[model samples]
Target: MTSPPRRLPGEGTAHTVEQSAGELARLAMARMDETLGWYRELSAAQRSQVGLVAQAGISQFVEWLRQRERHAPSAISIFANAPQELTRAVSLRHTLDLVRTVVDVVEARATSLAGPGDEQLVLESVLRFSREIAFAAAEVYAGAAEARGAWDARLEALVVDAVLRGEADDSMQSRAAALGWDDVAGVTFVVGRAPLAASSPDAPAATVDSLRRAARHLGVEALAIVQRDRLIAIVGGTRDPLPVVEHVADRFGPGPVVVGPTVPHLFAAGRSARAALSGLTAAVAWPGAPRVVESDELLPERALAGDLPARRRLLDRAHRPLTESAQSSQSPLLETATAYFEHGGSLEASARALFVHPNTVRYRLARITDVTGYDLTRPRDAWAVRVAVTLGRLGGTGATPGPAVGLSDAGQPAPVGRRGLEESSNL
Candidate 1:
């Protein structure tokens, strides 16, 4: 059998603390108003809720000292009587500040609230109770944080999906706003294969969170979600997203990571998302591409992969320019460039086939570079130039072009024996 609990000498002190609980709560509020800038800024309704919490704390302390509670006082009940909104209005730090202020008020009045020989007990109890309250506050906030994190994760996925699917309506905008994504400027989309380690359904969120943190460290705003095998990240708050993508490129799985062109804001992010995803699909064609290749950089591959927009861009920027160059000038750059590719990139060979001086071939090559920005001498540029020329000749539907002057059935310029005069045009 348990021994009867011995009576403590603090009964008189407990009775005094209980009787003065209302006045003590008022004193704590006055002290908070003087010391806590945040407290004074609370709206009237919030302040009223806070007052109830303080009153509960003081009455609970009296019971704790009376041995009515054999265990640590439950702060859960203190918050129970208060409005749920109070938890958010008052952060854990502010709650702790309130606790400290109340503790200070109680300690200052230990002399009056305690019986003659019970002053020491009252002071020690305040110190112990304050420690308990601190622990309780941490526990409460930790629980709140977990619940918030889960909710935010679901909301994040919805916002990301909506953007990817081009459904960013007012409802989606409001949902994105809930996740703090409103007003993000210079938004861009990045797509890459999810890391192998995050292949598990439960593991992807943790990986995305790491990416989000890395982006935020650079002052970029980011939202992330993993769809199927792909990890999509929408980052903003920076005009140049190149560095931001490079910074987090290593966090993706081993494959080409594609960053789309930046848009003005979140609402325009679907354009970026489509391009980046298309680029990621086409990236496998170029094994030597950089770890973080921009969507614009993969236009040729994407065109070859049947992406209409990329095909249109190649037609406008690459293929059409070469054909147009022939109209304004007598030299046939398209025929010369094709022969240059057929003869193993030999500039002199292409010159012999065209019967122009090597210097003329060199000049036309320079003009080609100017017309389309593709340097035929470089391997990558050579490949892109050839692809564009082929697409233009075979696919150029409405253009002012055909096999000019010198010809073979194969559409290449037929070689002429060295002519007395060299090819020259000033246009």
Candidate 2:
């Protein structure tokens, strides 16, 4: 068994300090106000609370001195009598200032306050008690800090859940507001695999911290959540999200990271979230997809996977523009594109099929690219155009049929180039 702590030789001075405790408490308060600016800044209510805490410290010191077998009072328990709000108003540093003032006052008066020849004992005891008070102050503040961190984490999780669920109601807005998301603009959603922790169960928090640190380094605001194996982030205050997402890409686990289109604010972020989630879900279809795939870039795969929004997007972004161009400009942009793809992207083969020169076919392909944003020469753009053409044919009404130049099985290609020249001359 451990031996009992040896008693300091100041038990005789215990009664001396008890008699002067009231005087010492008054002096400590006066010195704290005079020497510490923060102490004087405390509100009237907070000042009263500080006075009570100082008096308690001195009384507790005397009580410890009077006990034959001394036990230091629990430092954590010192703030128990004061209101919890007092800890918020008076910071730990300022509490140390009060403790220093109390120690200084007692030490300065030790010679007169102690019994004859016991001044040294009184001064030593004051030093020892001040050390305990400092330790106690640290414990109190640490506990408060821990509680605050936990509360903030829970609030963050709630806000993330609300965003994911597309619940942008007033209650959801209020929660986001509580988390200081009000100032953030141009919100975007990013979806990727969550990083695996090296060891600890707190890996989720560690992963989140890594994301936050990366975002801060890049001067962006981010809120993250780990849902099972997936990590989702709502990034804000950036119109250009690709660079921001690229900078923090390594924070995710090894997988495709997809960024959604940016919205104006957090409430509209649900649109971004939906698009990101759709891309993430269909990312596997394109195994060689980019590290940071824009949500719209995955439209073909998402549409093939039966995503209605993706299907609608393909039609709006590709088919509608080409059809409008063909009607207004009298160019067979769509027919030439269909023939070019069907003939395995051979310009000469498409030209013969359309009864136009190879140069004419090349010029029409360029116009197709201009209208649909897909260059028929590239493989990925060709595939996207193929999907958009299929969607268009299936959805279009009164699609005119002209030449059997390998359009769709349902309808012939509208001959608007050299093929249109021959037919119009015969007419």
Tell me which residue pairs clash in candidate 1.
none
What's the C-alpha lDDT at position 322 in model 2? Answer: 75
| Residue 356 local lDDT, model 1 | 85
TM-score for each predicted model, relative to the true structure = 0.86, 0.77
Clashes of each: 0, 0
How displaced is residue 59 in candidate 1, in Å?
Answer: 2.4
Q: Per-residue lDDT for 211-318 in model 2, tens only?
A: 888997888889886666667788998999899999999988888999999999998887787778778877888998999999899988877666666777888888
Instruction: Give me the overall lDDT of model 2.
Output: 0.78
Residue range with the least summed lDDT across 10 consecutive positions in model 2: 406-415
Error of 2 at 255 (Å): 2.1
- Ten-residue segment with the worst summed lDDT in candidate 1? 418-427
Report every candidate's CA lDDT: 0.79, 0.78
